[model samples]
Target chain A: MQNLVDHTVEINKLLARYGVKFGIYKNQEFHEQLFPFDAIPRVITHEEYSELEKGLIQRVDALNAFLKDIYSEKKIVKDNVVPEDFIFASSGYLPQCEGIIPPKGIYSHISGIDLVQAKDKSWYILEDNLRIPSGASYPLIARELCRRAAPGTFKENNVVDNRNYHKLLKETMDYVNCGGISVIMTPGRYNAAYFEHSYLAERSGCVLAMYNDLFVEKNQLFYRDYKGENKKVGVIYRRISDEFLDPMSFNSESVIGVPNLMDVYRAGNVAIVNAPGNGIADDKGIYYFVPKMIKYYLNEEPILKNAPTYLPFYEEDRKYVLDNLEKLVIKDVAEAGGYGVVFGSDLSKEKLEDMKQLIINESRRFIAQEVIDFLDLDIMENGEPVPRKADLRAFVLSGKETKVWASGLTRFSRNPDSFVVNSSQGGGFKDTWVLSR
Target chain B: MGIISIEKANNLYWLGRYTERVFTTLRKFYRIFDSMIDFDDAEMVYSEYCQRLSIPNIYTSGQQFVDCYIFDPKNPDSLYHNMERAYDNAIVLRDELSSNVVSYIQLALDAIASAKGTAAPLFQLQQVVDYLFAFWGCVDDYVENEECRNIMKTGKYAERIDLYIRLQYHTKDIEKEFTKFVNRMKKTNMHCNLDKLAELTEIINTKKEFNTEYQEALNCLQGIVEVV
Candidate 1:
């Protein structure tokens, strides 16, 4: 294990040499920061992995069914499992995609479900990132570096190679490819996950294109080369947000979006990875009903459990949340990336009262969960070991078959007391290794 | 293998031009630096440099010119300014060129930033020159696509010709460099007008006075678009 730590240090240095960095904007200036890697990997046993595989597939399946149902049928809403107001009033529910059925009818094709182990050694779901989840490249590159640094370690231990992430990604894109070339569209290099975008494009054999490089012509997406040759683009794994996907459809003022991409997507001329309008399934309010969705759609009990969540939209749940305001963690449903998450204990008495009143006024906008006593992972701080909050983002890819990448991105909070492990919030990441037994 | 976008191609061509401009000007500045060591009044060389580069002479003193003309990011002809331009061009074109190419330019820019306070400026200047050479070498060895090579060569040759004219190199040297440049362009499949090539040859052979007949040479060059 000590040798493994030494190897990790060497691997991290090599990663820096390769310019493997995540870019962030601070005070309107772009800065590239190294994502810290921990020697300690989250090892999953084969039995555990098999169980997780089943759970993840079921979870994503339900999420995809939920998205399709919300967009088209409204059966889930009419059945009163999820409230109509929650579907209609939620910011993530895109009305533009009311009747649009994506290619192969799959939404949340690549779902990044955030999970954290409890102190009791049981896993609990944190949040679902159905839209443009990143961090897959970090572990994929880290594993390569680790293999180079500790060739003997991999030889000795039967660790499953996580390098197949790119292959899996390519297969997933190809499986859903409408007709032409696969393109990984980026907003630009200044984006937070630009490194992942470009690296994945290179590894997956997909052309990395920006908005200017791609355009809609004759209701088909095409990538324009420097020589002005337009190659038809079939599958586009765009890293941009849904609102910024097409200026004509969503944010009319957005210059980073293609002019008529949504029209093409509507025309079923191209396949979008994870599809558009997947945010409806990932909304914090919707997250509370995922376990129920698994039972409803898959007709099986959820293997993994969601953190005991309460949507304030329900009169009963709202009363419970208001009563236990100080014990619960209240989250604003529309916000993500560790934002709008407030620990009830962190607030003063006056603030708690204010929050209670706000939740009462805007009941549909908030969801509360009992803070799980999650296990803390030990990471090196200065020279000594310090316990820090860490969360795992397991990537689940659904194509012809649902598959979960063996490796995951384990993000840890740099601040000892902080629970937020988002890269935007001064957190670092470690490569997760699912051990083969 | 080549990830050439229209924006990236434009950036790469300009990057090649700016990097060459900095390298050639830095070498010329060394000569001015040698003259300044002996003479007290060194403002003439700085003014001449500014005039030759077709830039405004804003500096009132030798130190000011060194600060503004060599290191200022605001000055369009400054080494610091050109490096910034080179970085901007190289950053977007990383998918096309070798990754090392971008890193070398970044290292040179970093050296420039740190050397701003150093007493001996040539120490840093030498590093920049070495890095620029390595950048081109890396591009040649690592960049596999012929179109990318052609675009880079076009910028390199165009900038070299401009520099040769400004520095007033011998006609034989100019002819040799221009011929190599034209041959490289031809090898890389860049279309150039045969008439412009003939006119360039004539000008080099005749040693035509540039001040009086430079406009005619410029017009002849304008007729040939370096197909990127």
Candidate 2:
């Protein structure tokens, strides 16, 4: 571990050489910043990983099933297991995706399940990213560089090689491929996760395509080459948001979208990975019902536990949330990337009262969760080891079969006092090592 | 390598042009830097260099030229600006040209970024030239697509010829670069203004010295790519 720690600077330089960066808009100006990497890996024992693997696979399967049911039968909502208002009121629920099922009925081919281990040693899922979740490439490349930096350390540790993420991704794309070439469609270079979009495309051996490079003809998606050649697109791992995916179908003003893409998708001629309208399942408000969804859809007890969440839309939960306003963390259901999150403890008396009034006025817009006293991981700070808040985003790939990648991205907050560990909020990441033994 | 978009084709061509522009101009700057230390009217070399490239002589002194032309991110004609443009084009070509090959451009850009106002600016700036050479070498060796490599090289060689003729290199050197440009242009399926290439070639073939028809030569080279 010390050997790995000693090579942090060199590893970071390699990361920069490979252009491991995320862009952020600050004061209306774009600033591209490197996502700092720490050498100390978040090591998980094989037994622990085995448990996590089962939980992640189970959770992702349930999420996929819920998506299928919501768009088709709505059995859960009709049976009063999950309220109809939760599904209809969600900004993620797209009426355009109704009655049309994706190829293989897989809604989220790649699910990034964010989890944190509590002080009690039990793991709790904080959120589910059914949409375009990134950060997989960070640890994927870091593990590559780490192995090169300390080859002996890996051999000594009996760590499973996490370098096969690209292979896993390729397999997922291939599983749902209707017939032609698989392409990873990106908005453009200005997107925050452009590096990952391009990197994953390169590593997965898929054509990295932008909106202009693709077009729809005769209800089929085609990738246009400069030489006037065109190839049919089978599966598109679109990295753009759902609303901006098809200008003709969803957002008429979106210049980044392919016109009539949804028409092709509706015709069953192409597959969109992590099918559109997935926001309905991964919504923060929907997060509270996932455990119930696991039982309702899979008929199996949820292997993972949700971080004690309270949906404020409920009269009882709203009363509880309002009474305990100063002890909980309030999250706007529609917000992501650590935005629209307010910690009650960090709020002033006036601010807390203002938040309570806002919650009362718009209860459906918020879900509050109990702050889990998550265990902190050690990182080298100023040549000394110190503990920092961290969380793991375990990737669950649903192809022919759902499988959890052996490794995950473990992001840690750089600020000593902050608990937010998103790269957009200026956090560093470490490679997660799932031990073989 | 798989399917190049028209936008990507343009980016590849400009990537080639900008990288070469930086490489050749940095070598020129080094020579100018040397002359600036020993001669009084040495700063005039920048004005001459700018005039040849058709960029405005916006600097007040030799030091200001070095700062603005080499480091200022605001000046669109600066070396830093060219490197930024090179990266913008290279960023989109990661799939066409492998990441291993594209990384050298990133390294060169980083070199320039860190070299600003340093004690050893010359040493740091020289590394930028080294990285560009390495980048071209990587492109030739690692880029598996022949058409992609040719398109980029056509942009590269065309830019080099323009700079060489503008800076008044020997006729033999100009002929050598023009030959390379024509060779790459012939390999690419992309449309190039053959008239421009032929006129440039004719000018090179007929003239003993480029001093007389330098502007015409520059005009022909600039028009080589019919589409921007």
Candidate 3:
């Protein structure tokens, strides 16, 4: 541990040399900044990881079943387990993807489940990112560099190698691949997660393609080469959102989209990893019912717990939320990346009254939850250990069966007073060490 | 490996061009810097360099030229700008060239950023040249695709020839660099203007110096790549 702490600056220099950065758009200008790395690892004991492994697998499996059901039979809505308004009214819910089934009936091939451990060591799920979740490459490269910087740390500790993420990601892509080569499509190098897009493609041996390099011909996607030869693309792990995926189908002004891509995907000629319309399953308003979804789909109790969430659309919950607006954390269902989240205690009396009225006026657009007193992890700052709020984004990949990558991206707030740990919001990440023993 | 997209091919070719431009131009700047210490008209060397590259003379003096031409982020024709362009292409070609080889470009760019306003700017800038050398070495050792490497070298040799002729290098040096350029151009599937190549070859064979037809030779070299 001492050796690892001593080599933090050395590892950071290597990260910069490798260009492990993310792009951010502030004031309508693009800037590339490094996703800082902390040497104090978020270590999980084998016993704890085993439990987390089961819970994450079960939760992601239930979410997948929910996505499949929502797009097909509408069983959950008809059975009255999930409200129909929440499924159909979301901006994430796309009507264009109503009838088209993804290859292998798999909607989310990669799921990033964000969780936080409370002060008592109990873990709670904060959110589920089914569409396009990044940050796996951050820790994967960090662990590789860390092993070189402090070889004695791993030799002295029982750390599981987290480098097999690319291998597992490749297997997941290959499992649902139709026939031809796999491609990881990106908007451009200016996009936020471009480093991960190119890095994963290189590591997994998939071709990294831009929209201009791809075209739809005869309802099949083909990658065009300089020699004018076309290679069929069987599976595309696209990094763009669904609304910007096929310009002809969703957003006409989207220049980054491949024209008629949805036509090819709808024809069943190709597979799109984490298929379109997955927002129906991961909507924050629907998060209040994931426990019920676990029981409804898997016929088992949920292994993981949702951070006690409340939907204001319910009359009883609305009254309770109105009465307790000063204690709960209200989240806007339409926002992400640590935005649209406000703790009730942080608001003044007048603002709290305004929030209460906003909740009363727009009942379906908000979900309030009790603030989880999550435990803080110690990180090295100016050669001193200080506790900061942290969270784990555990990646669950579903190929033949759901499997959790033994490692996760443990992001923490660099600011000592903040709870938001998003990289865009000035957060740094640490290597998650899942023990082997 | 030969099957690359036209966009990627363009990036690879220009990546070679820009990286070589920074390298040779920096070496030339170092020589000019030494000459500036000995001569009264120190800034004349920069004006001559600007004329050679066909760019406008924007610097007021020799020291300003050294700072802006090498380190200024705003100068479009600066070495820093060319290095950034090299990185823009290299960042997307991770699969064609391994990450181990691509990282040297990143290191070189970072070296340029760190050298800004340093106490000993020459020492810091020298590290940029060293990293560029290391980048080329890593490309040779780590890049497995031969055609890709050749395409990059085609751009490299072509730019070297252009710079050499414009700076009135020896006819023998021009012939040596043009031969190397033709060796690479013959391997790629990209179309080159054979007429321009023939005219340049004739000029190298007959003319003793670039004192008469310098601009004409530069134009022929520029016409080698069909810029569609």
Q: Estimate each model's TM-score.
A: 0.90, 0.98, 0.98
Highest lDDT against the true fold, candidate: 2
Q: Can you write out model 2's per-residue Cα lDDT over A119-197, one digit (the tens) per residue?
A: 8888999999999989899999999899899888988999999999999999999999999999999998888999998
* All candidates: interface RMSD: 2.8, 1.2, 1.5
- Between the candidate structures 1 and 2, which one is better when assessed by TM-score? 2
Instruction: Put down candidate 1 lDDT per residue, A1-437, tens digits, no spaces.
Output: 55666766677766665567788878989998888777766677777777877888889988988998988888888888887887887788899988989888887778999999899978899999999999999889888877777777788877889999989999888888899889888888788888788778767768878898888989999987766677898999999998999999999999999999989989999999878888888989889988888888788999999999998888999999999999999999978889999999999999999999999999988999999987998887666678999999999998888899998999999998899999888898887877788
Docking band of candidate 2: medium
> Where's the lowest-lDDT run of ten residues in candidate 1 chain A?
A11-20
Model 2 misplaced stretches (Cα beyond 4 Å): none
| Candidate 2 lDDT by residue in tens digits, B128-157 | 999998998998898888888888998998
Query: Model 2 residue A113 lDDT?
Result: 93
For residues A18-52, what per-residue lDDT tens digits would candidate 3 score against the true structure? 88999999999999999889999999999999999
lDDT of 1 at A400: 88
In candidate 1, which residue ranges exceed 4 Å CA deviation?
A: A1-17, A34-47, B1-3, B26-35, B58-76, B98-101, B114-121, B124-127, B184-202, B209-228
Candidate DockQ values, in order, are 0.34, 0.73, 0.69
